[model samples]
Structures are given as C-alpha cells and as structure tokens.
Target: MDLPDPQFSEFVTAFLKDRGLPVEDLQFHSLPSDGSKRLFWRLSPQSDTSFVAMENTPTDDFSKRENVAYLMIGRHLFQKDLPVPEIHHFDLANGWFILDDFGDASLQESALPKERRISLYESAIEILFRIQTEGVEGFNTEWCCQTERYDQYVMQRYEANYFRDAFLHKYLGLKKDWPELENPFNHLAATASRADNQFFLHRDFQSRNIMVSAGKIGILDWQGGRLGPLAYDLASLLIDPYTGLSSSERDEIYQHYLRFLNKYDPRQVEPFRKYFPYLAVQRNLQILGAFSFLSKMRGKTFFEDYISPALKSLRHLLEDLKDPQLSPLKEAVHS
Candidate 1:
C-alpha cells in the first residue's frame, strides 16, 4: 500500500526532532492493510536508536473503562515477565502511541532455525496459561459479557448474520436460507448464552497480534478484551488465518493448555474441557462469516488465508460434539 501523506510523515519527523533524537532522513515502514484501526510506522532518523510511531484510527475508540482495563491487564502481563511490547508514550487524545522498536522481529519474517519453533510455541502456551489464571483480575468479569451470554438477541449476533447476508450471499455466492438456519442458530445461541464457560478472553489473541523478537513472542492489538472462555483466544491463535499451525502442533498446545488449566483451577478444568470444543466450533463459524464479510463488504480479503484452518477446527469441534441440537449445524457446515 502507498505510504500515508507526507504531512503525517513530516509531522512524525518533526516530532522526533523536537524530542532531540537525531538529524537525518526519516524512513517510514507501514505494515500491511489488514489491521486498519491502527497505523504503524518505523521511524528511523540515521541514528542508532529507532522507534515505532502508531496512530489509532477513529474506529478504534474504546470506552475509558475498557481502555483502562486493557492497560491494567497489559501491565499485569508485563509484571509477570511475559514477552509483550513495552508502551513508551501514549496520547489517547490524539490517538498517537510510541512503543519500543522490536526491529524486524516478527514470526512472519523470522530467520530462526526450525528447531526453535517448538520452543517459541511452548513459551507462548506458558504465558497464555498464566494470563488465564492470574490475568483475571484487571477486568470485571461480571460486567464483561461471556461467550455463553452471546445469544441470538445479543448485539454481536448481528455481526455473524451481517457477514453472511451482506458478504457471503451478496459476494461469494454462498447463500443460506435464514429459515433453514433458524433452528440450529437458535440452538447455538441458547447454548452459548447459558453462560457456562467464563474466563479472561484476549479478544484478538492470535499470531498476527503476536510479535517475535529476540527469540521471544510479544502480544499486541489487545485493546478489546472481555471475560469469556479461554478457548476463544486459543482457537483464534492456533487456528489463526495468517498462520495455520499443523494438527500435531495444535494438539500439543491444547494438551499443554489443559495441563495448565488443570493446575490453575482443578474445579473448572472439566467445565473448560467440556465447553472448549463448543467454543471452538462457535468461534470458527463466526470467523468464517466475518472473513467473508470483511473480504466482500469491507473490501479486505486478507482473511482468506485463515479459512482452511478454521474449517479444520470446525471439523475437529464436530468430532467432539455428541449433542443432537448442534449436529445439524455441523452437518450443514460439513456438507
């Protein structure tokens, strides 16, 4: 994509100069357009030190409570020594943020040897466990809606329907009769709204939201958080569209997560396991619809890469479900 206007670039250059950094040409590296809410640029001023300049778009305005809750959670993760980016400075009023420049260190472009992949994922799993256990404090779970509370009447339900109707039918030619889907849809909604599974959800916790630097992974794009099932974020990561980890690798991670959860709260372990597959199925379907909507209506097909893994997860979820109410939907998807 073309770089943003020279005015913004010049403004950033001047801002850095006033900060007494250095004097030279300013080079800006804008990331891909998949994440539109935030704009990232690498500000290099010919000096040894460099930093990342970020601007949160207007659409990313979060409630003060949500913002504070996220920051508190981020701080808690940092305190636990998790490999997340450090916030340098933030101007919420102007939507400008500066963070430590991790430098060409992303899993997408990593030059690490093959042997290091397992270690990286292991570390990621460990930290995820820590968050699910200890990261429950910063946010109020009682207020934040859980996946179980996400019924057909919930406002979020429209996100899925809109994705399907406006995008899948309108653009992809994959149309579903609302009447045929009503029963299964209602069942899915009721199942989710039972509020059975609840935990700290990272909302967008996935590989793309993760940064790999110095053989460590750091999480970003966590402005939206809530109290929900751990599986939501776990599925988002392992079944991430940008990166589809192998089945064996995903299984290994799932086992690791189970172990961690069991150790954290033995009582909730069974419930988590019982509901994890259901959450995965629900989340995968929502994502599939969202991807189509984003690709068609929103004019961003970047989510296409995530479709196959998401489908695979749907299949796996189906294998775990013995509930008759969900079987028809599973058949519809599989068919």
Candidate 2:
C-alpha cells in the first residue's frame, strides 16, 4: 500500500524518533477500510511497540468536524476512565493521529455458526454500562460531530428517512410513497424517544468497533458519541446482523444486560425494556439504510454483504413487535 503525505511521514518520524525508534527500521502496513472515510495504517518496528496512525485528508465540512470530535470525545472518555483507545498524539487541523494498536481481536471475531461469541459480548456489556452511566459526567454535546442527542427528529430524518430513501427507494429501486410510511415511522420515533436520553451513547456501538486489546475491552470510532437513550446502544449490539446471533442468544445476552443494569440502576430496567424493541427496529432500519447508502452511493461494497442479513433481522423484529401502527412499515419491508 501507498504511504501517506510527507507531512504525515515527518510527524511519524518525529513521533517514533522521540520514543527511540529509528526512522530506517519502521514498516508500514495498510489496514482494511471500514465504513469510515479515514485511512489507517499500522506502523511497526523491530521493537515491541507498534502504533496505528490515522490519516484523514478532509475535503468536506463534516469530516473536519469529525476529526475534532474524535480528538475531544476521545480525551473526554479517557479522562472519565472509560475503555477507549489511548490517543497518544493528534493534529486535527492536518488530520493525523498516533494511537495505541489494539490488535485485531474484535468482539465479532469469527463466532461459530450455531451460537455467536457470548463471552466477548458479555464483557463488552460491562464496558458499555460504564460508557452510559459514568461517561455522561461532564460530557459536552459540542464534542459531538453530528446531532447531540438521539431524539425523534434524529429518528425521522436520519434513521427512518435513511431507510426509505437510501435502502428502499434508491438501492432497491422501489417506488415508495413515503407519505404512507409516515404513520409507522412516527410511531417508532415517538415510542423510542420516550426512553431516557441523558446517558452517554456510542451511536455505533456494534461488534466491529468493540476491540479486545490485552484481554480488556476497548472502544473505537467514538466520534459519533453523544447523549442518547440507554437502550439504544444495547439495541445496536443485540440486533447486529454481522454477528449472526440467534434469537435465543440475543435474549440471553439481553437478559444479562438487564441484570447488570439492575445492579446499578434498578429504576431504569423496566423503562429500558419498554423502549428496547423500538430502538432495535430503529437501529436495524439505520443499518439497512447505512449499508445500502455506503455500498450504492459510496462504492464501499463490503457493506453490501451485510444488507441481506440486516434486512432479514429488521423484518423479524418488525414481526415480533406487531404494533398496529407499524403496518405501513411492515408493508414497506415486505415490498
């Protein structure tokens, strides 16, 4: 793979040389691309220490803001004693980061066909609770690149419309009368918004972003973190089609999460349960929408592989919920 620009090279050289690693002995390896537009590389040397460098040449406004978010939110989480990666050094103006290399054992690390990786997710749940309960202290909404809270407006515009416009209309080429979808979309948004939205939320807290580094869970891709529902992130984890967790397995993990939550905040358990299905369905819609948009619009075909599974999971949850108001959404899904 190609190396970064000269400025990044200069930064890396100085960053390593200051730590006693020679510039001549370094090896650069390109990491696989994910949903993010940022380029990442693993810089290794003869010594035991290796660093993951992120290179983001922002051409637009959002990417620039995202870099700022990554810097600020990362520092906030680290200061709050959360399980996020240690950002050693960064230059958001130029978009470069020197970060600790959390070696490639994700929570989704190749589970068996019948059952998903239970232990990995269970461990992640513990870290997740901390991210919610403890991470909210002194959290500034300004640190969020996107919207500061996961509310009805966010649901309608981002998740619901994203599903209809990107997945159904554009990707599937369905001539959907979106006005007909208004009722079910409103129902979902209204119901989900009733949950407590004061907690710290990692908006994309899926298996891929949850790393297992040195036998401890470390979170990544936190630029999208904000104040949101407690159940929303958990919903994202449970309905993650990438893991291919069976319905039974989802229930088991969910119950475990509830028990864990009860130990800390018993009052939240019932409310969390009440809004979970809506959030799960909402998250699945976002997934299908995101996968479709990323694959069809952005040409990132890796997302296309998960589209079918996500759609299947979305439909299953819609069926289970069986909300009379969601019939229109059910129609859209079936169509």
Candidate 3:
C-alpha cells in the first residue's frame, strides 16, 4: 500500500519538535493496515525512543467520533491502570496521534509453548477481569464508536445479517432459500441478548489485539468497547481462530475463567458458562462474515486465510452444542 502523504511526515516532525524530541534524523516507516481505515507509522530518532503514529481520515462524523474515542478511551484505560499504550500527543483536527511504541510482540505473532501459553492466557484473563470491573467506573457511553450496548439489534442486524449477506451470499454465492436458518439465528441472538450487560466489554478481544511484551499483556484496538455481556469477551478470547487454540486448551481456559469469576462473583459463573456457547456461535459467524467482506469486497485477501479456521471453530461449537433450535443454522454452516 502507498505510504502516508509527505505532509503527514512533516506533521509528525513538527509534533515531535513541539514535544522537545530530537527531529534531525527522524525516520518514518509505514505499518501494515488492519481491516480498519486507520493508517499507522513507526517514528524513530537518534535517541532510544520511538512512537507509533496513527492517522485517521475524518471523512465523516462517524470517523471523527471514532478518532476522538481512541484518544479518550486510551487515556481512560491508562488512568485505570489497564495495559493500554500511553498517548503522548493527539490532534483532533487532523486525526493523528503519537503513542508509546509497545513493539510488535502481539500474542498472535508469538510462538507459545504449551505451558507458556497457559500462563500468558491466565494473565490475559486477569486483565479482562480488571477491565470489566475497574474499567467500567468512569467509561462514557458517548465514547463508544458504535452502539452503547451489544443488544439484540446489534447481535441480529450487525452480526447475523452480516454473516448471511457477506459470507453465505456474497462469498459462497449460495442462492438457496435460507429461510430455514432464520429461526435459529433469531433464537441465538435472543439468547445472547439476555446475557448480563453490566460490565465493560472489549468487543474484539482476540489474540491479534493483545500485545505481549516482557511477559506483560497490553490491550490494543479497544475504541469499540462498550457496555455488554461479560461472556462476549471471554468467548472471543477462547474461541479465537487466529490463536488456533485446541478444544482441550479452550476447555481448560474456560474453566480457568470460571474460577477467576468465582473469586469475585460466584453467582455469575453458572450463567456465564450457560451463555458462552451461544455467544461463541454468534462471534464465530461474525468473524466469517468479516473475513468474507474484507477479502471479497475490500480486496484484503489476508483475512480470507482465517476463514477456514473460523469455520472449523463454528462447526465445532455447533456440534458441541446439541440445542435443537440451532440445528438448521448448524446445517447451514456445515453446508
């Protein structure tokens, strides 16, 4: 992809100069884009300091709001002692900011031994607990990029319909009458919507968004967080396709999360477990939809590589869940 404009480079240099950082030998390198519209760069100088510059095009009001939220939420999380990068400077008018360079030690990029994987996940789960409890105290709903709550409308319209339109119809070209799957889709959404929404949720809590450095886990890309079901993030973490965590490993992590929950609120463990599978189905389907949309429509083929793993996760979760109401949806996915 093309690098950011030369003006952006000059802007970064000026931003650094204002911060009293040496700018004589500053170098800028573009970072690979994820599925978002944001552009990232790594800025390094003669000193032993580096920062990541994120630039967002304020194309519309939604984009502007999202950029603002990134700064607002990053500061909030940092103040709450969460493991988010510290924001050094931000320009809301131009939609760019400087952040601490956490380096590229994301959990998704790490090759973990079995025992090490378990320990790291334990740490990650502990962070999740704190983010849910402590991070919710002063969080503002207006800072949320999307809906304030992951309610039934979001589950049904944004996730389920996204799967139908993007994955089933657009990517696979499946023209069959899929009316039979509607009941199961609605049932799954309804079930997930009833989950506890009293905690902060990291909507995309997968391995790729988790940075691991010096045996510490730092969370990233949390501008989309909102008040939602506690089980949603847990399901996202455990059933993540990128990590390729085995079923046994997932079971162990699930149990570990329950134990963690029990230490604080014992009453929530049973219901959380009961609702996890349903959320897994919903989450996995949403991943497939995103992969399809990104690959086919947006011309980002890298996302397509994860589709098979996502499908494997979806089928496995469906098989493990013997709910009769989900049979049609299961068959639809299996086909």
TM-score of each: 0.81, 0.96, 0.96
- Tell me the tens digit of each residue's lDDT in model 3 across 1-335: 55767777888888788878898867678887678878888988755888999999788989888987888888999999899999988888889888988888878776366668888888899999899888889989889888898888888887888899899999999974578878998899999887899889888998888889899999999888889888899989988878889878888888888888898899998888889889888888889899999999999999999999998888989999999999998888888
Which pairs of residues clash in candidate 1, taking residues 3 or more apart in a chain or in different chains? Answer: 148-192, 148-193, 241-306
| Cα misplacement distance, residue 53 of candidate 2 (Å) | 0.4
lDDT of each: 0.62, 0.88, 0.86
Model 1 agreement with the true structure over 122-142: per-residue lDDT tens digits: 777777766755666554543
Which number leads on lDDT? 2
Better of 1 and 2 by lDDT: 2
Candidate 3: list runs displaced more than 4 Å. none
Question: Can you write out model 2's per-residue Cα lDDT over 1-335, one digit (the tens) per residue?
Answer: 86788889889889988888878956678987588778999988656778899988777888898998899999999998888878998887889999988888777774443444777677888899889888899999998888899999989999999999999999999986689888889989999999999999999999899888665888999999999999999999988877888888889889989998899889999999889999999998899999999999999998899999999998899899989899988888887
RMSD (Cα, Å) for all candidates, in order, is 3.9, 1.5, 1.4
Give every collision pair in model 2. Answer: none
